[model samples]
Target: MKSVLITGASSGIGLQLASDYLENGYRVLACGLDVVKLKAVLSHPNVTHYAFDTTSVEQIDQALGQLSAPDLIILNAGNCEYVNDAQQLDAALFERVMSTNVMGTVNCLSVLLPRMQAGSHVAIVSSSVTWLPLTRAEAYGASKAALDYLARTLAIDLQDASIDVSLIRPGFVDTPLTRLNDFPMPAKISVTDASSRIRRGLERRQRVIDFPFLFILVLRIFSWLPVSWWQSIAASMRRHSL
Candidate 1:
């Protein structure tokens, strides 16, 4: 049976994916910060649980040292915090988001990459927020944007090693994370739907897998608009929010 390792397996999309993969007969290495939560979801015989904070490099290294090389590694652990008042500029909030989303992924990569072989694949969970500037997403969007670039660059660099990289950009999946959002989320999908789409995309080995067709289409269109136009729109939105 093929093996896969998923970070953030305690809840949301990660939990769903871990369950689905177990059902499909793959051995799963489930990593999450919450030991209780991680154990609750990973009850299957094929699933092994590792409790480690993604923000801690030492923790990631120790956890990874105990596992064998996985055929697929999903670096999906991340947190999102908005800049509610950009004028105030919450540097702490920005640091927290970047530490978890960007540095967290890097920490996992440092430990996981060396163990992966030529046929192994790495999937980075970015967000569709990177497609356009959105209100209150200053920190969250910037982090995912960095991840998008990192995944693309890894794709190019890992080509010679035959290690495929897949970038997953989901449009608001209805997970615990999004449950905290105060704004309306268009085309919000269930965790099951998100996991299904992501697995299918991985099977096809697509470079980019963006979900909810219409949502992605809209974002892509907006991304094509002139920079000044989007800037004006963003500024107007910021003012309205104030």
Candidate 2:
């Protein structure tokens, strides 16, 4: 049986993906910081739980060292917090968001890269925010943009190793995370749909898995607008949103 490891399996997209993969008969190593939550979300014989703080390289290395490398590894553990006041510039907030979304993924990659065998697949969960500059996405957008670049760079570097990387840029997945958003989310999809798209894309060995056709299409269209025009549009959005 093929084995897979998914971080953030305690909740949201990660949790849903864990259940789906397990139900489909894959040996799943559900990695999350909360053991109780992981168990509660995924309580199956085929699932094993590994708890670790993704931001800590020590924790990731020590935790991952205990097990054999899986055929697939999904680095989905991340956090999002918008910049409430852009003028104030919250350094701590940016650090917290970057430490988790960027460094956390790096921590896992550092350890897992050595463990990966030929034909292994690794996926990094980025956000479609990289397509267009949205209001108050300072910390969140920057981190995901870093992830997008990192994933693409790795795709080129890891080609000779026969390990594939899939960059997942999902737009507004309906989860506890998105539920906290004060603004409207267009074409937001359920966790089930997100998980299904990710699974199918990975199965097909697609390099990038961007979600919810209409949403991504709109973002792509907006991406073509000149930067000056987008700035004006974003300013209007921020005014109405606030």
Candidate 3:
């Protein structure tokens, strides 16, 4: 069987994808911070579970050091925390989000890239929030924005080596991550739908997999607007959400 490894496999979309991939007959290497949770969620004969904080490269290296490379690697682990007050500019909050969502991915990539070879695929979970600015998403949006560029650049650089990179950008996936939102989430999709679409896209080796067409279409349309115009729209949303 082809092998697939997924980070953030303890809960949310990660757990869902791990389950679905295992069902589809892939040997799964599940990674997360919680050992017990990973063990309980992916308790299959073909699934191997590892626990390590994503932010620490040492821990990641230690965890992945001895493993044979999986044919597919999904770097889906991330954290989401909003900036409640932009005027205050919470450095700590920004760092917390960046460390997990940005540096954490980088930490994993540092060790994992060598294991990827020809015919290997790597998918990174970025957010649709990167399509346009959102109210109170300074930290979250910026982190995903970084991933957007990282994935695209990797695609270009890795092409000659025959390694494929896919950027997974979802609009309001209804996972545990989105449950923390206080404002209304338009066009939220269930984890199952999210997993199905993502799998189909990866199988095709699509460079970008954006879900819930209508929602992303709206964002794409607004993305073409003048900066000032979009800023006005964002300000309006901030007022309503606040």
Candidate 4:
């Protein structure tokens, strides 16, 4: 049976994807920082729980050392922290977000890429925030933008190697993390729908898997607008959100 390894499998899209993959007859390696949470969420004959801090390269190497590479690897582990005041930059917050979202994926890839057989697929969970600047997303958006670039670059470099890299840029999904949002979220989808979209995208081996047609479309359109126009709109949005 083909096996898939997913980080951040304890909650949100990662958790949903793990369950969906298990039902589809794939051996699931559910990796999360919290072993107890992983066990509590998933219990299956073909599912194995791996606990490791994705921010730590040593921990990732040690944890994944014993297991052969899986057919698919989804680097979905990430954290979100908004910059409440852009005027007052928070270096610590930026570090925390970057360490988890960007470096965390890099750390995993550093270990897994070598062991992965050719034809294995890797998906990195970036955010739709990269499409257009949003209010209070300073740190979060920057990290995901880095991921977007990283994933695109990897796709080019790994194409000849027979490995595929998918950049998943998801809009708002109804998960615990997004529930904390105080602002409006247009076209937000359920976790089940999000998982289904991601699975279908991966099956087709799409290089960039962005989601929820209307929402992403709007962002794409807005991104094409004049910079000053978008800045004014974004500033207006910030005013209303407060």
Candidate 5:
């Protein structure tokens, strides 16, 4: 049986992916920071849980040391915090977001990459917010933008090694994470639909898995607009939110 390891399995997308993989008869190595939550999700016979903070390299190394190499590894553990007041820059908030979303993925790669061989795949969960600047997404958008670059670069670098890298950009998935959002989310999908789409995308070894087709198309189109136009739109969004 092929095995897959997923980080942030405690809740949200990670949790949904873990359950989906397990149901599909794959051996799942579920990693999460919450021990209680991790245990709850590992109720399946084919699933095993590992608790570790993704931001801590030492913790990742120690926890991952016990496991064998997996056929697939999804670095989906991330945190999102908006910059409520861009005029008053929050360096600490920016750092915290980058530390978890960017650095945490790097920490996981350091330990997991060596264990992976040819045919193994790595998936990084980014956000569609990177497509165009959104209100209050300064910290979150920046982190995901960095992840987009990282994943694209890794795709080229890992080609000869036979390890494929997939960049996943989901638009408004209904999860615990999105529940905190105060704004309206258009074309929002349930976690089950998100998981199904992700699994299917991975099975096909897609380089980029961007979801809610219409939403992504809109963003792609908007991203191609003139810089000034986009800037005006963003400014308007901020004003309305205020």
Candidate 6:
């Protein structure tokens, strides 16, 4: 069976993806911060549970070192914390978000890439928030924006190595994380739907996979407008939430 390794398999999209992949007959390497929680959520003979703090390089090395690379690797682990008061400039908040979303992924790649065989596929889960800035998403949006660039650049650099890179830009997935949002979420999709879309895209080896068509289309349209115009729209959205 083809093996698939996924980070953040404890919950949300990661959990759903793991379950889906297992059902499809792929050997699963499920990585999470807590082994107990991961096993509680996912228990199967074909599934191997790996516990490691993605933000800690040493932990990742200790857990993943010496293991042969899987056929597919999805760097889906991330943290989402909003900067409610952008004016206050929360350096610590930015650090926490970036540490997990950006640097954490980087830390994984540092170890996993060398072990990956040719023809393997790697997918990066980036948010559609990168397409257009939203209110109070300073840290989360910025981190995903960085992933967008990183994934695209990796696609170009890893081409000769025969390693396919997929950049997944999901609009609003209705996972446990989104349930905590105080603002309205337009076109939010369930975790199952999100997993199906992602699996279809990966099977096709598509360079860019964006979902919930209408939502992404709206963002693309607004992105075409002048900065001032979008800024007005964003301000209106903030007002509506208030």
User: Is candidate 1 or 4 superior in lDDT?
Assistant: 4
lDDT (tens digit, per residue) of candidate 3 on 1-242: 99998999999899999999999999999999989988976799999998999999999999998787889999999999988888899999999999999998989888889878899999999989999999999999999999999999999999998999999999888888889899999999999999999999999999999988999999999999999999999999989998
lDDT of each: 0.92, 0.94, 0.93, 0.95, 0.93, 0.94
RMSD of 5: 0.9
Clashing pairs in 4: none
Model 2, total clashes: 0
On lDDT, the candidate that comes out on top is 4
Name the lDDT value of residue 96 in candidate 2.
99
Question: Which run of 10 residues does model 4 get worst, by summed lDDT?
Answer: 60-69
**Local lDDT at 152 for model 6:** 97
Candidate 2 residue runs with Cα over 4 Å from true position: none
**For each candidate, what TM-score against the reference?**
0.96, 0.98, 0.98, 0.99, 0.98, 0.99
What's the distance in Å from true for residue 72, model 2? 0.6
Q: Name the TM-score of candidate 4.
A: 0.99
> How far in Å is the alpha carbon of 136 misplaced in model 3?
0.7
lDDT by residue for model 1 (80-147), tens = 88886768998999999999999999999988888789989999999999999998898999999999
| Cα RMSD, each candidate | 1.3, 0.7, 0.8, 0.7, 0.9, 0.7
For residues 123-145, could you state the per-residue lDDT of candidate 5 as single tens digits? 99999999998888989999999
What is candidate 4's lDDT per residue for 1-242, written digit by digit as tens?
A: 99999999999999999999999999999999989999999999999999999999999988998689999999999989888888899999999999999999999999999888899999999999999888899999999999999999999999888899999999999999999888888899999999999999999999999999899999999999999999999999999998
The local lDDT score (0 to 100) that residue 93 gets in candidate 1 is 94
